[model samples]
Target: MRKQLLGLAAVAALLTACGDTCDENKMVSGGFDNFPAPSASADGPTPGSAADFQKNVQDTVHFGFDRHDLTAEAKTALENQAEWLKKWGGVNLLIEGHCDERGTVEYNLALGEKRAHAAKHFLMSQGIDTSRLETVSYGKERPIDAGHTEEAHAKNRRDVSVVR
Candidate 1:
């Protein structure tokens, strides 16, 4: 019993020592959408870091309900992303397609794929290399906003560009 208590105490101490560092690392490595954006300072994220990319260029674009087409706003955001990619020639991206919760799982998955492909094609049209872009569809499986309202559903319908 004494040995077990000592082990528990050590574990507690280690966890205490971990503190906020673990959370920070997780947020930097793509935590929930609510995680605050990294602050820009003199010693901000490195120029080619994911945080830098997110800060310098928009990383997400929203789609209309049940539609995979890019909106004018989405096209503008993708244009900015293309410019950023052009500047960082060596960086690659993972385009994640997501959808609202209204559709059947299979249907949502297919729609999400189309959404991701739309973004990829736009980037390619802007002169970004095809080899540097990959895409995946999460459908409604991973929603940034979990509420059932229209605003929430709108938020869920998106394509996110993650630097890889």
Candidate 2:
């Protein structure tokens, strides 16, 4: 298992070298569409195998319509992520709040901020240091799926985390 994980990490590193953001910790997806959101990749201690390391970290979790409450599923996801974070100390992360393309821009921005803060609070409750987290809101300015459909709107509502 270790060997296989190492091989995957090697592959990820090679892929990242091709034109991705390579942080000292791990390879972060460079020039990604949603740059502020929890990138689709992890940036953390590589732990001898990138795959093993990234497997511990996860992409950001999405929210529901006009709601900032972290769903039960989201709670589980954050708990898992917190576990991964505890594995690597002396780290900082950014929480980017987001929202769907509904409501006024200003209102959405406030909503997004609340969502991001909520995630940060949850992570804190899980034992992550508050000093390690910062919250920002993008509102509806950034969207992972940009169609005028419910599916796209749903995907846009999210709280993403980035290791710094």
Candidate 3:
């Protein structure tokens, strides 16, 4: 009986030693810190309202490598954007198309234009007015991520909708 009690004590001590007090350098965040914050609309509501819009509405869409086609994800995001556009009828939107750092300047610019057009078309199809939507190609000139990694490249291939 004494041996049994001593074994239980040893087991309890081992469990206690392996408790929450163990130190670890585990990752605890989603890594959104590397991405830039959504830009606020100019001539629209104040920061409070803009923050609400950014938090509630979709403001960006990502694309595949060397492709301007809208994926289902892009369509979903654009659908949300359309709703926001409908709610704020008078606001103009600037769709800034971007590309990864692989293509030549001219090619990237053209590709970016296609990406912007693709997003614009989707928004228009969802009932957004053509007049309220404008597009500009930033190409690889304004990459959201500067690293040479694939993840960074993926992030760079995107269209950002800035309210005007």
> TM-score, each model?
0.75, 0.68, 0.70
TM-score (C-alpha) between model 3 and the true structure: 0.70
Question: Backbone collision count in every prediction?
Answer: 0, 0, 0
Output the lDDT of residue 17, model 1: 91
Show model 3 residue runs off by greater than 4 Å: 1-49
Model 2, span 19-136: residue lDDT tens = 7464656645577563534323356434523344355666579899989999998898888778877887766678899998889999999999999999999999999999988999
RMSD score of candidate 2 (Å): 16.1
Model 3 agreement with the true structure over 31-120: per-residue lDDT tens digits: 877444565444443443455557777888999999999999999999998988888787778999999999799999999999999999
lDDT of 1 by residue, 27-98 (tens): 454556544346444567678778899888999999999899999999999999999999899999999999
Cα miss at 126, model 1 (Å)? 0.2
Q: What is the lDDT of residue 71 in candidate 1?
A: 97
Q: Tell how far residue 159 is off in model 3, in angstroms.
A: 0.3
What is the TM-score ranking, best to worst? Answer: 1, 3, 2
**How much is 130 displaced in model 3, in angstroms?**
0.5
For candidate 2, the TM-score is 0.68
How far in Å is the alpha carbon of 40 misplaced in model 2?
16
The candidate maximizing TM-score is 1
